[model samples]
Target chain A: MLKVTNDQVAGHKAGDGKLGPLIDDLGRFYKPLQSNERGSNELTFYTSFSTNTRIPGPIRRFFPNFYGTQLVEASDGSSLQPHLVLQDFNFGRVNPSIIDIKIGSRTWDPQASEEYIQKGLKKDRETSSLPLGFRLSGFQIYQNRELGFWKPERTFQSLSADEVDLLLRKFVSSNTSANLDLQPDCSFASIVYGGSTGILSQLLELKAWFEDQTIYHFYACSVLMTYEKEFVSNGKIPCAEIKLIDFAHVYEGQGVIDHNFLGGLCSLIKFISEILITPEECTTEASPKDIQKNQIYFEELIK
Target chain B: MLKVTNDQVAGHKAGDGKLGPLIDDLGRFYKPLQSNERGSNELTFYTSFSTNTRIPGPIRRFFPNFYGTQLVEASDGSSLQPHLVLQDFNFGRVNPSIIDIKIGSRTWDPQASEEYIQKGLKKDRETSSLPLGFRLSGFQIYQNRELGFWKPERTFQSLSADEVDLLLRKFVSSNTSANLDLQPDCSFASIVYGGSTGILSQLLELKAWFEDQTIYHFYACSVLMTYEKEFVSNGKIPCAEIKLIDFAHVYEGQGVIDHNFLGGLCSLIKFISEILITPEECTTEASPKDIQKNQIYFEELIK
Candidate 1:
């Protein structure tokens, strides 16, 4: 029997007596397919993506390994529903820290309804998506066995560019559990984001693919980053992974560049790269007004 | 500088002042591409196979991970030569035992020249391939730290069906280094060929693909089986892998069944399955004349 996954830190999840994604013992995550066009679109995206010969082997690794779909009893005790079976990133890990950052300033497609576009635009503007071209949808840090999971409030989703940098620093900080008030040590930055197999390299590889690929325009899609928090405390080399997820808003690019997605990815890469290079600047406190100025300056620079 | 791999037990290799496949510190096997149609055909095959979306993800794992190609200094001190860079199966292993078994009774394709067909037929008839549909090209076993390596003479390639079974038995014999005279206990059979991830399961998976896939007809291809012999002695779980190699003779299937290759694969699978089920029969020695009768019987049975 599949159990509801408690580790999901972002996206549409079970709340208010609703059902959500399920996980099995075999390290498979079962995401209940939405019954609307969104569900069919996601299924279509994965189906095409899985069989898309144009995408090279390395680039294909960036997405989750799709194991087809299965009909399972819904978590809400409803009838059997078809679920997308995928490789669980947090499988076989102890005290895993996870973050989901939705890419692109324009989260809604041009073909979307006016209401949908308006709603998406409002959220995009309210969050870091407009200024930074990416927004932290959600994140959860496994501080310690005693302190347990630590996650910022929903308000954190509306962080400015500078606050987003601080969140990124906190995500990699090894000393977060020991001293909450202390600045981030960013000790796990090298293991989680640096090196040849690290998240930074993986993202760069994805960026290389997106630079030329005019196959798809990804809207409201996220880059989910995960790593074992226990590895940091134990001084063990960690296996950190970043996977592209949430393809419901994906659409065909029709031989044109996916500039929106490419821009967001590049912006995210810049922020992470800065955090890796200048860890001190990541945790440095700044006045609220100064943060607002930095946000405006960063947006203008990208523009 | 690339070094000639000492562990290669079969196929065209460095000998008699000739260059062969080279290995580097990065666990990559560099096979010097032939400056002929065969070279281009193989390169085409890999390029197509790598990007082939028709082949499912699971089936794709059976082939070697192709890393494009590189022009390296010819090992024979000639001009620059192109080489196919592939994942080395023997990489990062201690005391590895390896075997190369060329599949199919018909090793040459219909497109081959008369001369090539005649040469291939003679070799196939001389070996177990004609009688059993598969022939052992070569094998090398690491006996121990003291005994170093133990390999049969080239004459072993011409074994009858019964003798081939005996040879397969010898492969899984853990006591070979300790007592060469004793019959094989077949101790490593389950570890190397049993379980879900074992060679048997992997071969079955390949067989499943071959059953339906009509994209290409593989001729003169070899299934390379490798495992760390030290694991058997140390009681550690062994990681055994079976990879399809040598793609020079491949041809377009054109929607026709690859019966030649499939037959050989099934024959090989039958032999291994028997070894796993009845270890006692695997070690049972018969008279030379009786072995000859078994060969004729087996040939007739397959026909």
Candidate 2:
């Protein structure tokens, strides 16, 4: 009953020597039998599907961040096209202060790979090692219908050291208290991030998810950042939106405690802090010298 | 330590034979100790809390239906106020076409109580019988901030038999297909219900939830019907919005399949059909006779 194309089969094989395709078993690589599309199955699927298609209200409206994959019974017995019924996160309309960016493999720092692998092994005993890299592609930003909201290459290219540091600071403060746990004052955090209350809540949720590495098993996940530009007013940093997408290889367990997400998150935070965090100061604590280091780190990440 | 007042203790004990409160174990009943509020914990929580309060975007903007309860740790060891961070369902601004009405214990037919009790026992083995008359009072519509959106007594008193039939038909048609399941035509349904795509989605979701007896165990859940006036075009019948709320007693389990919701839904549907469905045709098949039956069923339910 399930029909898959030759190119899709090839792409799946190309992912790993014996590793399966990124998608879950419920999902299959679908190609339009009638149309002569040249791109990858995901690319073609995304391209052909119209956003105006009537997605169930719960999925389209409530669960905005994740890609909700639904199974439709094809009455005609003809093969159905595999396309994402994506919720529109109109950052330009919703919150103009935030700049959304999709970070993929290009953003994965090789220097921190060893650390990530070590952490992943310690957390997940069944699979004692992480994959070579998070196989998410930055170029796949075109998957979302909203144009210009996420231009990873352009945004990263244009970013100065100070901008990245400011962005990182805002993200960190929102999720964590002065201590690791315990958000002492909810009012203060809400006040600090005046207009972008929605963005802050989103990031905090994503942070919570990332912390719970036991249940979530994301393979080559893409992290989307909706960074606040004017986060600081008179030097009080707020929060930004950081969410994971493309859960093709994501799995949930009843009580699986691990450091899969945390390891990756730590590696990322470390890499970003290396550039932004001064040798004398902690990542949480900001300093005058952080500006100069930000420039240095920005240049490194850009390269 | 968790501190509680004398009245709060009384309310908790009164819910069951020493079964501490109507709230889940994860939830504890709390009263604003200083306030002179003389309502149930839920009503007091809803009334005292500000809708404009900066609810985390996830709970506020996204996932509007479910009551997301969070534990706030008091740093000073001072008691934190237990209040609902409710998202406002502004029918006036959002969907002017719809009139929202909350149906509570008053809607439960005393005549049908015996049948419902037998049905409930056959479904859930653990809870062998239905709770003595779904103890939710329709008068408790004031539990929500925006008053009069759910004045069921007033709404029913004003509505004629024809109006009641029209509302029920719209709700049933939207949820169930002509043959039951398989809504072949999406566009037709969307066209019939204009503007409030979000409301339509919410009703569909509630319908699905009710259909699923395995997990959802809503004993005395309140039904909030957002009935549209122009449900039909040029006398053509269409669907409207109907959603369930007040998930105070709702529970989920792997194998706890129950007929609590189904019994209520079917009874209402059958009653509506008796009034609307003529001997000559199916309820799905529209006819002028439906108008006649609508009046009859309206009186039956009201009585």
Best by TM-score: 1
User: Model 2, residue B60: what's the lDDT?
Assistant: 28
List per-prediction Cα lDDT, in the order shown. 0.77, 0.32
**C-alpha lDDT of residue A151 in model 1:** 65
- What does candidate 1's lDDT look like per residue over A168-226, in tens digits? 88789876653443367788898899999898999989876765565788989999988
The TM-scores, one per candidate, come to 0.47, 0.24
Q: After superposition, how far is residue A122 of candidate 2 from its true place, in Å?
A: 17
Model 2: CA > 4 A from native? A1-81, A91-166, A170-215, A227-242, A252-254, A262-293, A296-303, B1-303
DockQ class, candidate 2: incorrect
Error of 2 at B282 (Å): 53
List pairs with backbone clashes in candidate 2.
Answer: A161-A294, B275-B293
Error of 1 at A271 (Å): 56
Candidate 2: residue A108 lDDT (0-100): 18
